[model samples]
Target: MSRPEVLCIGALLWDVIGRAPRRMAPGADVPGRIRHVPGGVALNVAVALARRGLAAALLSAVGRDPEGDALLAEARRLGVLTGWIVRDTGLPTDCYMAVEDSAGLIAAIADAHSLEQAGAAILAPLDDLPAWTGPVVLDGNLTEDLLAAIAADPRLAAADLRVVPASPGKAERLEPLIAARRGCFYLNRLEAEILAHRACPDAASAAEAVVARGAARVLVTDGANPAADAIAGGPTLAVPPPRVTIARVTGAGDCFLAAHLAAGLAGQPREAALRAAVEAAAAHVAGRDLP
Candidate 1:
């Protein structure tokens, strides 16, 4: 396989989503659809980049199980390089379960114990690969210690990094990267608030707060509100997402991050890249097929 233009490092697993077309309440049984798909923070970003015709590789751990086998096949089908993925014999593949209704995602659980256990072993392959100067999409699924190590690792110091909190609960795990100013942080409003330790009423304010907290760059999003992007010395730019009917919300942020990175790599200006990211996210939420 050819060298990948990007490396997505983090959870590589399955997403079991139960979707209900109507509003749902706790303990309320509603007719809906349940499907298992190849997903995870890193996988989602890699898939999004691949769809945009960007070659990407996954640096993660997957169990040597049937589920892992199937997941690898699906990733290959989607054009994501899986040769660097570690296969753990003692653990089951990780998986995320979520319930979504017409309103949006309600609740979810991520069972990534295996990846957490595999830890730095998943990244060992990096030593053998050619020098990577392209964007490395990282997620908060890594353990705090491991994240801290990465923040100071010389191997990654020169690469363009784009980091995202896998979920609001994992937002604090990214503090190491934030303090190191290692990457451009991509996260939703709540995640931003969790990192900044303060309430922000809007995306622009959230972006500014994160940047002030030692982040090199930031992209803050609020569902259908406004999304903001800020660089250390540049003005924070905010743009509203195009109106579109809601379809799925799971990978929306990944789509936005991937699109923005791709646009920027293609030489789009900051404002234009942010606009394209918002547009791409809107299209994803509108049920439009990516790429």
Candidate 2:
């Protein structure tokens, strides 16, 4: 098989999202909608890239169970290449559960135990392939050891690595990447603060702090506020997102990262790429299905 333009590595599983149209408080049993969709940090990014006409492949683990079979089918339907995914018979498919209210994501739990348990087996395909110097989108959902190994692996040293923290809780798990200065980091304000170990009043401060901590490049986003994209020894670019009434919040950040990477791969200027990413995120939150 031919190599894909981009490879997404990390969690690939179902997203079971419970959304309520009204404000939610603890212990409030309000009626809501629950839907199971093909999701996960890597999968979401791959789908977003595929939607933009990019050839994207997934490098992750899935079970041999029925749910895994269904998810693989959905991934193919969405144009994501699953040939590199490891189907482990000993483990069950992973999943992510989230609760969202009108305000935003109230809480989330990522049950990515299988991917963590699969360890290095999920990455076996990379060993057989030629040295990939293209873009690789990596998520923090993988175990810390695996992430460290990937960071130091010579096979990926020449690739354009783009890493996301996955969430605030997993932010510190990206320390290996940050210490190695291996990739362009993508994260929201809270995740940035966690990684930087300081409170960032705004995106600009967060981006600066992360870069000071040896991040080669960083993008920090604050909802509705301006976002900052910073490169070492370069001017930090800050751009405000288009304000829109949020219809959903599960995959907005993934959409933003994918759009930015796609624009960069297309040779768009730095500022232009950041603008396109914010625009894509705004459209996603506004429930606009982008092509």
lDDT of 1 by residue, 147-230 (tens): 898888777878898999999999999999988878999999999999989999999999899999999899999999999998
Q: Name the TM-score of candidate 2.
A: 0.98
For candidate 1, the per-residue lDDT at 288 reads: 81
| lDDT tens per residue, model 2, 1-291 | 567999999999999989899899998888988989999999999999999999999999999999999999999999999998988637889999999999999999999988998888877888887888999999999888999999988888898999998998999999999989889999999999988889989998999899999998999989999989998999999999998987889889999999999999899999999999999999999888722
Would you list the C-alpha lDDT of every candidate in the order shown? 0.91, 0.92
Error of 2 at 103 (Å): 0.4
Runs in model 2 deviating more than 4 A are none
- Error at 186, model 2, angstroms: 0.2
Question: lDDT score, residue 26, model 1?
Answer: 91
Model 2, position 32, has a per-residue lDDT of 85
For candidate 1, the per-residue lDDT at 253 reads: 94
